[model samples]
Target: QQQVKQSPQSLIVQKGGISIINCAYENTAFDYFPWYQQFPGKGPALLIAIRPDVSEKKEGRFTISFNKSAKQFSLHIMDSQPGDSATYFCAASMSSGYSTLTFGKGTMLLVSP
Candidate 1:
Protein backbone atom coordinates (compact mmCIF):
# COMPACT_ATOMS: atom_id res chain seq x y z
CA GLN A 1 0.00 0.00 0.00
CA GLN A 2 1.11 3.55 -0.73
CA GLN A 3 0.86 6.55 1.52
CA VAL A 4 0.69 10.29 1.19
CA LYS A 5 1.90 12.53 3.97
CA GLN A 6 0.61 16.06 4.28
CA SER A 7 1.83 18.94 6.36
CA PRO A 8 0.26 21.72 8.41
CA GLN A 9 -2.84 20.19 9.90
CA SER A 10 -4.50 23.60 9.66
CA LEU A 11 -3.88 27.00 8.17
CA ILE A 12 -5.27 30.54 8.27
CA VAL A 13 -4.85 32.94 5.38
CA GLN A 14 -5.97 36.51 4.86
CA LYS A 15 -8.15 37.41 1.95
CA GLY A 16 -6.27 37.79 -1.33
CA GLY A 17 -3.37 35.85 0.15
CA ILE A 18 -1.89 32.58 -0.94
CA SER A 19 -2.39 29.28 0.84
CA ILE A 20 -0.10 26.36 0.24
CA ILE A 21 -0.36 22.72 1.25
CA ASN A 22 2.27 20.12 0.60
CA CYS A 23 2.34 16.36 0.31
CA ALA A 24 4.98 13.71 -0.10
CA TYR A 25 4.63 10.18 -1.34
CA GLU A 26 6.82 7.11 -1.14
CA ASN A 27 5.41 5.22 -4.11
CA THR A 28 7.26 5.78 -7.32
CA ALA A 29 4.55 4.02 -9.28
CA PHE A 30 2.08 6.75 -8.55
CA ASP A 31 1.76 8.94 -11.61
CA TYR A 32 -1.03 11.28 -10.76
CA PHE A 33 -1.13 13.96 -8.08
CA PRO A 34 -4.36 15.73 -7.39
CA TRP A 35 -5.73 18.20 -4.91
CA TYR A 36 -9.28 17.97 -3.69
CA GLN A 37 -11.42 20.68 -2.10
CA GLN A 38 -14.28 20.05 0.26
CA PHE A 39 -16.61 22.77 1.41
CA PRO A 40 -18.63 22.81 4.63
CA GLY A 41 -21.26 20.32 3.61
CA LYS A 42 -20.16 18.99 0.28
CA GLY A 43 -18.05 16.01 -0.62
CA PRO A 44 -14.55 16.55 -1.92
CA ALA A 45 -14.10 17.43 -5.59
CA LEU A 46 -11.05 17.57 -7.75
CA LEU A 47 -9.54 21.04 -7.76
CA ILE A 48 -6.38 20.55 -9.77
CA ALA A 49 -3.89 17.89 -10.74
CA ILE A 50 -0.45 17.32 -12.16
CA ARG A 51 1.22 14.38 -13.83
CA PRO A 52 4.69 13.13 -13.26
CA ASP A 53 5.73 14.39 -16.67
CA VAL A 54 4.72 17.94 -15.89
CA SER A 55 6.20 20.16 -13.26
CA GLU A 56 3.02 22.13 -12.63
CA LYS A 57 -0.59 22.69 -13.58
CA LYS A 58 -2.70 25.73 -12.88
CA GLU A 59 -6.36 26.53 -13.13
CA GLY A 60 -7.91 29.81 -12.09
CA ARG A 61 -6.67 30.45 -8.53
CA PHE A 62 -5.45 26.91 -8.01
CA THR A 63 -2.11 25.36 -8.86
CA ILE A 64 -0.71 21.85 -8.48
CA SER A 65 2.92 20.91 -8.68
CA PHE A 66 4.64 17.61 -9.20
CA ASN A 67 8.23 16.73 -8.41
CA LYS A 68 8.89 13.24 -9.68
CA SER A 69 12.36 12.98 -8.27
CA ALA A 70 11.28 13.98 -4.81
CA LYS A 71 7.99 12.08 -5.06
CA GLN A 72 6.22 15.18 -3.82
CA PHE A 73 3.46 17.53 -4.85
CA SER A 74 1.77 20.67 -3.64
CA LEU A 75 -1.25 22.88 -4.04
CA HIS A 76 -1.26 26.66 -4.05
CA ILE A 77 -4.36 28.78 -3.79
CA MET A 78 -3.81 32.29 -5.09
CA ASP A 79 -5.90 35.32 -4.23
CA SER A 80 -7.67 33.18 -1.73
CA GLN A 81 -11.03 34.25 -0.42
CA PRO A 82 -13.15 33.23 2.52
CA GLY A 83 -15.31 31.25 0.18
CA ASP A 84 -12.25 29.27 -0.77
CA SER A 85 -11.84 28.06 2.75
CA ALA A 86 -12.22 24.32 2.84
CA THR A 87 -10.71 21.05 3.88
CA TYR A 88 -8.09 20.34 1.26
CA PHE A 89 -6.65 16.92 0.64
CA CYS A 90 -3.66 15.76 -1.34
CA ALA A 91 -3.97 12.47 -3.17
CA ALA A 92 -2.04 10.17 -5.44
CA SER A 93 -3.00 7.28 -7.68
CA MET A 94 -2.04 5.46 -10.81
CA SER A 95 -3.79 6.74 -13.89
CA SER A 96 -4.02 3.34 -15.50
CA GLY A 97 -5.68 1.55 -12.64
CA TYR A 98 -8.95 2.21 -10.90
CA SER A 99 -8.92 5.65 -9.39
CA THR A 100 -8.44 4.42 -5.89
CA LEU A 101 -6.76 7.46 -4.45
CA THR A 102 -4.43 7.32 -1.52
CA PHE A 103 -5.23 10.49 0.39
CA GLY A 104 -3.42 12.53 2.95
CA LYS A 105 -4.67 13.55 6.38
CA GLY A 106 -6.07 16.78 4.91
CA THR A 107 -5.49 20.44 5.72
CA MET A 108 -8.20 22.69 7.06
CA LEU A 109 -7.84 26.16 5.64
CA LEU A 110 -9.57 29.25 6.97
CA VAL A 111 -9.47 32.33 4.84
CA SER A 112 -10.24 35.38 6.92
CA PRO A 113 -11.19 38.83 5.82
Candidate 2:
Protein backbone atom coordinates (compact mmCIF):
# COMPACT_ATOMS: atom_id res chain seq x y z
CA GLN A 1 0.00 0.00 0.00
CA GLN A 2 1.14 3.56 -0.66
CA GLN A 3 2.36 5.09 2.54
CA VAL A 4 1.12 8.51 1.60
CA LYS A 5 -1.97 9.69 -0.27
CA GLN A 6 -2.38 13.01 -2.09
CA SER A 7 -5.42 14.61 -3.61
CA PRO A 8 -6.43 16.77 -6.58
CA GLN A 9 -4.15 15.32 -9.20
CA SER A 10 -4.19 18.71 -10.88
CA LEU A 11 -4.97 22.29 -9.96
CA ILE A 12 -5.15 25.70 -11.63
CA VAL A 13 -4.98 29.08 -9.98
CA GLN A 14 -4.98 32.70 -10.98
CA LYS A 15 -1.95 34.82 -10.46
CA GLY A 16 -1.50 35.85 -6.84
CA GLY A 17 -3.99 33.26 -5.71
CA ILE A 18 -3.48 30.65 -3.06
CA SER A 19 -2.84 27.07 -4.13
CA ILE A 20 -3.51 24.31 -1.65
CA ILE A 21 -2.56 20.62 -1.77
CA ASN A 22 -3.19 18.02 0.86
CA CYS A 23 -1.78 14.64 1.88
CA ALA A 24 -2.36 11.85 4.38
CA TYR A 25 0.06 9.16 5.40
CA GLU A 26 -0.52 5.67 6.71
CA ASN A 27 2.61 5.17 8.70
CA THR A 28 2.66 6.59 12.18
CA ALA A 29 6.38 5.95 12.38
CA PHE A 30 7.03 8.82 10.04
CA ASP A 31 8.86 11.57 11.85
CA TYR A 32 9.45 14.12 9.18
CA PHE A 33 7.19 15.67 6.59
CA PRO A 34 8.51 17.54 3.60
CA TRP A 35 7.16 19.18 0.49
CA TYR A 36 9.00 19.25 -2.80
CA GLN A 37 8.61 21.26 -5.98
CA GLN A 38 9.60 19.81 -9.32
CA PHE A 39 9.81 21.42 -12.71
CA PRO A 40 9.60 19.58 -15.97
CA GLY A 41 12.89 18.05 -17.12
CA LYS A 42 14.36 18.70 -13.69
CA GLY A 43 14.48 16.94 -10.36
CA PRO A 44 12.25 17.63 -7.38
CA ALA A 45 13.76 20.09 -4.95
CA LEU A 46 12.88 20.49 -1.32
CA LEU A 47 10.48 23.37 -0.77
CA ILE A 48 9.45 23.21 2.88
CA ALA A 49 9.43 20.72 5.73
CA ILE A 50 7.97 20.28 9.19
CA ARG A 51 8.67 18.06 12.11
CA PRO A 52 6.10 16.53 14.41
CA ASP A 53 7.29 19.00 16.99
CA VAL A 54 5.83 21.92 15.13
CA SER A 55 2.35 22.60 13.76
CA GLU A 56 3.41 24.68 10.79
CA LYS A 57 6.28 26.03 8.76
CA LYS A 58 6.71 28.66 6.07
CA GLU A 59 9.30 29.90 3.66
CA GLY A 60 8.60 32.78 1.36
CA ARG A 61 5.36 31.93 -0.45
CA PHE A 62 5.45 28.26 0.47
CA THR A 63 3.94 26.93 3.65
CA ILE A 64 3.50 23.47 5.16
CA SER A 65 0.87 22.68 7.73
CA PHE A 66 1.22 19.46 9.65
CA ASN A 67 -1.08 17.60 11.99
CA LYS A 68 0.58 14.93 14.06
CA SER A 69 -2.44 13.27 15.61
CA ALA A 70 -4.28 13.17 12.33
CA LYS A 71 -1.30 11.86 10.39
CA GLN A 72 -2.06 14.46 7.73
CA PHE A 73 -0.39 17.48 6.22
CA SER A 74 -0.97 20.09 3.56
CA LEU A 75 0.89 22.62 1.47
CA HIS A 76 -0.36 26.12 0.88
CA ILE A 77 1.24 28.41 -1.63
CA MET A 78 0.37 32.01 -1.02
CA ASP A 79 0.36 34.53 -3.82
CA SER A 80 1.33 31.93 -6.33
CA GLN A 81 2.98 33.15 -9.50
CA PRO A 82 3.13 31.64 -12.96
CA GLY A 83 6.63 30.54 -12.22
CA ASP A 84 5.28 28.50 -9.33
CA SER A 85 3.53 26.19 -11.74
CA ALA A 86 5.01 22.79 -11.14
CA THR A 87 4.43 19.42 -9.48
CA TYR A 88 4.38 19.45 -5.71
CA PHE A 89 4.94 16.34 -3.64
CA CYS A 90 4.38 15.56 0.01
CA ALA A 91 6.74 13.03 1.53
CA ALA A 92 7.37 11.18 4.76
CA SER A 93 10.56 9.74 6.14
CA MET A 94 12.04 8.35 9.27
CA SER A 95 15.69 8.69 10.24
CA SER A 96 15.81 5.07 11.32
CA GLY A 97 14.73 3.81 7.93
CA TYR A 98 16.84 3.40 4.79
CA SER A 99 17.04 7.19 4.65
CA THR A 100 14.95 7.24 1.49
CA LEU A 101 11.92 9.41 1.05
CA THR A 102 8.43 7.99 0.66
CA PHE A 103 6.54 10.45 -1.51
CA GLY A 104 2.86 10.94 -2.10
CA LYS A 105 1.52 11.01 -5.63
CA GLY A 106 2.36 14.52 -6.77
CA THR A 107 0.04 17.47 -7.27
CA MET A 108 0.43 19.53 -10.41
CA LEU A 109 -0.19 23.21 -9.80
CA LEU A 110 -0.78 25.55 -12.72
CA VAL A 111 -0.49 29.20 -11.83
CA SER A 112 -1.91 31.39 -14.53
CA PRO A 113 -0.57 34.82 -15.25
Candidate 3:
Protein backbone atom coordinates (compact mmCIF):
# COMPACT_ATOMS: atom_id res chain seq x y z
CA GLN A 1 0.00 0.00 0.00
CA GLN A 2 2.83 2.35 -0.80
CA GLN A 3 2.60 2.70 -4.55
CA VAL A 4 1.35 5.59 -6.61
CA LYS A 5 0.89 4.71 -10.27
CA GLN A 6 0.77 7.40 -12.96
CA SER A 7 -0.15 7.04 -16.63
CA PRO A 8 0.64 8.33 -20.13
CA GLN A 9 4.35 8.02 -19.36
CA SER A 10 4.64 10.85 -21.90
CA LEU A 11 2.37 13.53 -23.22
CA ILE A 12 2.36 15.84 -26.24
CA VAL A 13 0.28 19.00 -26.36
CA GLN A 14 0.15 22.23 -28.28
CA LYS A 15 0.82 25.62 -26.76
CA GLY A 16 -2.15 27.13 -24.95
CA GLY A 17 -3.80 23.76 -24.54
CA ILE A 18 -4.57 21.75 -21.47
CA SER A 19 -2.36 18.95 -20.13
CA ILE A 20 -3.77 16.23 -17.95
CA ILE A 21 -2.20 13.38 -15.93
CA ASN A 22 -3.69 10.93 -13.50
CA CYS A 23 -2.44 8.93 -10.51
CA ALA A 24 -3.76 6.55 -7.87
CA TYR A 25 -2.58 5.26 -4.52
CA GLU A 26 -3.15 2.20 -2.38
CA ASN A 27 -2.21 3.40 1.10
CA THR A 28 -5.06 4.79 3.17
CA ALA A 29 -2.63 5.93 5.83
CA PHE A 30 -1.22 8.51 3.48
CA ASP A 31 -2.64 11.91 4.36
CA TYR A 32 -0.63 14.38 2.35
CA PHE A 33 -0.82 14.55 -1.43
CA PRO A 34 1.59 16.60 -3.50
CA TRP A 35 2.42 17.07 -7.17
CA TYR A 36 5.97 17.79 -8.13
CA GLN A 37 7.49 19.16 -11.35
CA GLN A 38 10.99 18.40 -12.47
CA PHE A 39 13.09 19.74 -15.29
CA PRO A 40 15.93 17.68 -16.68
CA GLY A 41 18.14 16.14 -13.99
CA LYS A 42 16.93 18.31 -11.15
CA GLY A 43 14.96 16.94 -8.24
CA PRO A 44 11.23 17.38 -8.30
CA ALA A 45 9.82 20.55 -6.70
CA LEU A 46 6.51 20.86 -5.03
CA LEU A 47 4.22 22.45 -7.60
CA ILE A 48 0.95 22.07 -5.71
CA ALA A 49 -0.59 19.91 -3.05
CA ILE A 50 -3.81 18.80 -1.40
CA ARG A 51 -4.81 17.04 1.76
CA PRO A 52 -7.37 14.36 2.45
CA ASP A 53 -9.43 17.15 3.90
CA VAL A 54 -9.63 19.00 0.60
CA SER A 55 -10.94 17.98 -2.80
CA GLU A 56 -8.79 20.29 -4.86
CA LYS A 57 -5.94 22.78 -4.82
CA LYS A 58 -4.67 25.25 -7.40
CA GLU A 59 -1.65 27.42 -7.84
CA GLY A 60 -1.10 29.71 -10.80
CA ARG A 61 -1.27 27.41 -13.83
CA PHE A 62 -1.24 24.18 -11.88
CA THR A 63 -4.18 22.44 -10.27
CA ILE A 64 -4.60 19.21 -8.34
CA SER A 65 -7.96 17.47 -8.15
CA PHE A 66 -8.23 14.83 -5.47
CA ASN A 67 -10.75 12.13 -4.69
CA LYS A 68 -10.48 10.90 -1.14
CA SER A 69 -12.86 8.01 -1.33
CA ALA A 70 -11.37 6.64 -4.54
CA LYS A 71 -7.79 7.24 -3.42
CA GLN A 72 -6.96 9.00 -6.68
CA PHE A 73 -5.61 12.37 -7.77
CA SER A 74 -4.79 14.20 -10.98
CA LEU A 75 -2.89 17.21 -12.21
CA HIS A 76 -4.32 19.69 -14.68
CA ILE A 77 -2.26 22.30 -16.42
CA MET A 78 -4.17 25.22 -17.80
CA ASP A 79 -2.97 27.05 -20.90
CA SER A 80 0.06 24.84 -21.14
CA GLN A 81 3.09 26.28 -22.89
CA PRO A 82 6.27 25.01 -24.46
CA GLY A 83 8.11 26.15 -21.34
CA ASP A 84 5.88 23.83 -19.34
CA SER A 85 7.58 20.84 -20.85
CA ALA A 86 9.07 18.75 -18.09
CA THR A 87 8.59 15.64 -16.00
CA TYR A 88 5.68 15.69 -13.60
CA PHE A 89 5.44 13.37 -10.62
CA CYS A 90 2.58 12.74 -8.24
CA ALA A 91 3.58 11.80 -4.72
CA ALA A 92 2.10 10.71 -1.41
CA SER A 93 3.37 11.12 2.13
CA MET A 94 2.14 10.90 5.68
CA SER A 95 1.26 14.05 7.60
CA SER A 96 3.30 13.20 10.64
CA GLY A 97 7.05 13.01 11.13
CA TYR A 98 9.60 12.48 8.38
CA SER A 99 8.09 10.11 5.89
CA THR A 100 9.66 9.12 2.62
CA LEU A 101 7.61 10.20 -0.34
CA THR A 102 6.25 7.59 -2.70
CA PHE A 103 6.42 8.89 -6.25
CA GLY A 104 4.53 7.92 -9.33
CA LYS A 105 6.37 6.64 -12.39
CA GLY A 106 6.29 10.22 -13.74
CA THR A 107 4.71 11.85 -16.78
CA MET A 108 6.87 13.65 -19.29
CA LEU A 109 4.99 16.62 -20.69
CA LEU A 110 5.94 17.95 -24.11
CA VAL A 111 4.26 21.16 -25.17
CA SER A 112 5.23 21.87 -28.75
CA PRO A 113 5.07 25.25 -30.35
Candidate No. with top lDDT: 3
Q: Model 1: per-residue lDDT, tens digit, 16-113?
A: 99999999999888888888899888999988888898898989989887788888888999999999989999998999958789999999999999
**Tens digit of lDDT per residue, candidate 3, span 1-113?**
43999987999999999999999999999999888999998988889989989888889989899998999999999999999999999999998999879999999999999
Q: Please provide, for model 2 over 1-113, each residue's C-alpha lDDT reduced to its tens digit, 9 standing for 90 to 100.
A: 99999988999999999999999999888898889999999999988898889998989988888888898999999999999999999999996748789999999999999
Q: Highest TM-score: give the candidate number.
A: 2
TM-score between candidate 3 and the true structure: 0.95
Ranking, TM-score, top scorer first: 2, 3, 1
* Cα shift from native, residue 104, model 2 (Å): 0.7
Ranking by lDDT: 3, 2, 1
Task: After the best TM-score superposition of candidate 2, give how far the Cα of residue 83 lies from its true spot, in angstroms.
Answer: 0.3
TM-score of each: 0.95, 0.96, 0.95
Candidate 2 vs candidate 3, lDDT winner: 3
Angstrom error of the Cα, residue 49, model 3: value is 0.9
lDDT by candidate, in order shown: 0.90, 0.92, 0.93
Listing every candidate in turn, what is its Cα RMSD in Å to the true structure after a full C-alpha superposition?
A: 1.2, 0.9, 1.2
Q: What number of clashing residue pairs does each candidate have, in the order they appear? A: 0, 0, 0
